[model samples]
Target: MFEDAFKLKIRPDGLEKAAARTYVTAVRDVLEKIHRTACGKALLQSIRFHGYVVNIIPYPGADVCGADVDGDYDAATGIVMPTVRYTPGNFAKGGSCSHLPGRGWAESILFHELVHALRDIAQGKRRVYKGVVMTGGLHRYDTFEEFIAVLCEDIYVSERGNPHRLLGDHRGIAPLDPALADSFRFFATGSQTFRFVERFCRENPGFTKMLSRVPARFNPIAAYYKDPRKAQSFSNSPAAHERDADGVWGKLFERERSPTLPTGSPANLPPPRPASTPIRRP
Candidate 1:
């Protein structure tokens, strides 16, 4: 069942066989865990529906550890092609990082990319535009995407009680206002986090404006918040802002039990560059 839901493809010149096997095993374990969980089952169903494939490749000396290859999301067929490319040079000869050994780094990258794939699946078939222009104009959207992924990674790692295994660092790129991060963290768990994010964008015009540039279907916030389960999820959680007696939203931030650990720098570090272009629909 797990094999059918996720297909792993390693480039011929990617990590060596031993390293690749280790990475593949780690990925399978993560997917298995997700498949077993309630929220994960729903996400797995969406992934299966889209026929998303996970490709592992050698990073071409770029600083990025992984990318979701937005262009590969085929709305027509509901297929999403996501990849977790690695910087082979960054790993020690045996595919271990000095900071985190064995397939740890690669596992982190895979988890980060998986979160992205899940988000794409949840959003359904919407036109996805990539590049610096779309990212620059809608900086908040990009940050929000990273925020949710990192937060999910943090939750997974926390559940395992292993701080060192946390994935992609968000300190620089996706720095959420600490208070805001805490509030949303308390509000939802697993895939339900998407609902909190969508509500967030609706409350913040800066985020709403950026989402508006994309097609309505691709606007993750608007789409996922409308899910019938969204309201129910909120009602069940004590962390829901509406249940707070304190008038300040930041008060809800206090309910977060687990805090994120520093995951270090991202691979494929691109020099911060800005561009101006309206995100387009296909």
Candidate 2:
């Protein structure tokens, strides 16, 4: 079972067989570790993304690149396939995640593809989108989905800050790392964003009343991650001003200003990234 799980049989020209085996082993090790505990669910979900494979054929003018997931779900096999490509050059020989020896981007690509698979399983064809499963396609996620991936990456990075891994460096791109943080920045950001939108809708209910006409797109989950005060049209009224002065909406207000909250499991991680990103290798 383990062998089947970690297998990487596709061979690329100018790529070493030994290094390829090692990369497969590393991926298997991470998956095996995650599978042993309750935390394995996320990692396991990613395996279903194992689908069509491709090699990164290098061109002289090309820049370093990695695998991309094309979101087409294999209805027959129930798997989402990602095409893993490697750069052709000395970089490939370096074994860096950005290079051939590096499987960092591969891991992230796999995980991201799996997310599409999971979404399909949960929401069915109703929520399916296109172009997310192929190489370079994972970057096209919707705003909320992007947030989810970012937050997960933040948590993974903070928990497993290994020196040899090049993944989960979402700090610079987003104020709050998507991976769960010790301070829970992502949660706080999301919560604030949610409250803001919810309160805005209440104030001018008609402005977005049409949103309720359709159920799926205007989900509460999207609102759950926003700040009430930041709603586009929200303004401080006399009553709202008084409440703010009196701190009546203490919890709500606090969410925007570092609201204290519970912690999450330590094992959560973000999808891996290319070495070009600011991630330390583990």
Candidate 3:
């Protein structure tokens, strides 16, 4: 039904039709595989009903990002990604060296971006997956977004024979962490009763590094990814020491799994570089 879930627009000139068809087919197959599972089916439904046909353009940029989706989030066009650099291999100076993925890996990467597209559109909304409330856009730092995407991406990877297909930090650290694999194991056997937040937060999944990399302008984000003892005010970084635990990222960020916790779900700015900032494609 979502034959157009991702509309491929070739912005660059002189691209071959064969190249375009390959990408389109690869992405479609990924969706088909995800739809086979119960959880995947539900996720796909969430995006469809959200009034987003998710525009998927193969980004051709020099930046090392494999793919990223962050913008104003158009209802009709879904999360508009002006710079989704979906390509093979590590993006040049990737965190560490690793073998580049084959064209088949593109399908898996598309699945990764789909996680982003889902999270982006669900902002300001709430949905329950496997009894876990995906308060998609609520957090000040938007931590759960990456955790969930990486989690779901890894789950899909399991179905693909468990390759090195994680967000970034976790990529190549394979045999997928048993803790992370536990949830997918449930879904693989037709169960969705995953402890989304407990296990996910317990593992932390290099979220600090992800958030630390965010630009200073993206308020509510922290400074360093190493330790949390340092308190940086969510609103005013200068007043961090003056604030309390909530002020710093102590335990409040662990609300991802709290079904009872309330939740809510990046964007553009004006200046020399006004393009939308992606939600870390690494």
Candidate 4:
């Protein structure tokens, strides 16, 4: 299994090597914990992102920033090629993920890169693999896939509610909520497709508990909002009765999760809510 693992092209020098390795180990430990608690679908998300990082390469005598090279999702060969780079002086410097003390901070740096991986996977930039068989394929997403991804991120971040823990007192770090919302608007119609899933995961005790079961490899941010139970909708019904008003109303009331242009308030909307947001942890 290790044979197929992509060998590091640019090994870190001196202390850099040890630091990077330490970061990788720390990230691996986090993955193990997540595996024990994250949603299973998140595993699918991770499979698309694993083994594609090419890191610790020497500075190419230039100042270009890191970038995602691969394009869309592929069904065969689970690798998406992306190049992440940092000029010696222009990267995150301290805390749990820092490089100043010569400690590996790949987890902190790679956190956003992982988000790019998800974007690439959902956009069809990643190639799926089965054993040694590798075939190239692409999936241009429709609006629905985009909606689901957006809503999932919102649900994930909101539930985790550990912005400071993840953000590490950095002013430069983009707000997860706004960043997710931006992605939704850029790639999708911003439709209301996941209100049910989001609300159910937020309010239903049974579903909330299942979130811990989510696979570690998967983005906890995405899986938190994508409860599979939301897939169930009443047939040919505009005003479906919600068994648990708080737990079931969002899904039944709003078929989609996207916001509107006019932007009406929640109270003004009737059944099948025109607009809604993620479930608050409080």
What's the CA RMSD of model 1 in angstroms? 12.8
- Rank ordering of all candidates by TM-score, starting from the highest: 1, 3, 2, 4
Q: What lDDT does candidate 3 reach at residue 271? A: 23
lDDT by residue (tens digit), candidate 2, 128-219: 34322111111112243343444333333333332223222222222322232222122233223334335434532432233222222212
User: How well does candidate 3 score on lDDT at residue 39?
Assistant: 36
- Residue range with the least summed lDDT across 10 consecutive positions in model 3: 264-273
lDDT ranking, high to low: 1, 3, 2, 4
| Among all candidates shown, the one with the greatest TM-score | 1
Q: Which lDDT tens digits does candidate 3 get at residues 94-180?
A: 422223442234455556666666555554233222223222121122345554665555545554454553432222222332322
Worst 10 residues of 1 by lDDT: 273-282
> Looking at candidate 4, what is the lDDT of residue 41?
31
Worst 10 residues of 4 by lDDT: 133-142
Q: Point out the higher-scoring one by lDDT: 2 or 4.
A: 2
Predictions in order: lDDT: 0.41, 0.33, 0.40, 0.31
At residue 138, give the lDDT of candidate 3: 17
| Cα displacement (Å) at residue 208, model 4 | 15
Candidate 4 CA-lDDT value: 0.31
Q: Mind giving the per-residue lDDT tens digits that candidate 1 earns over 198-268?
A: 54454343423333333321223333334535534643465433323321222223223113312432221
Clashes of each: 6, 39, 5, 30
Model 3 ranges with Cα > 4 A deviation: 5-22, 36-39, 63-65, 73-104, 124-142, 160-181, 184-282
Off by over 4 Å in 4: 1-16, 39-41, 44-80, 83-93, 96-112, 118-151, 161-282
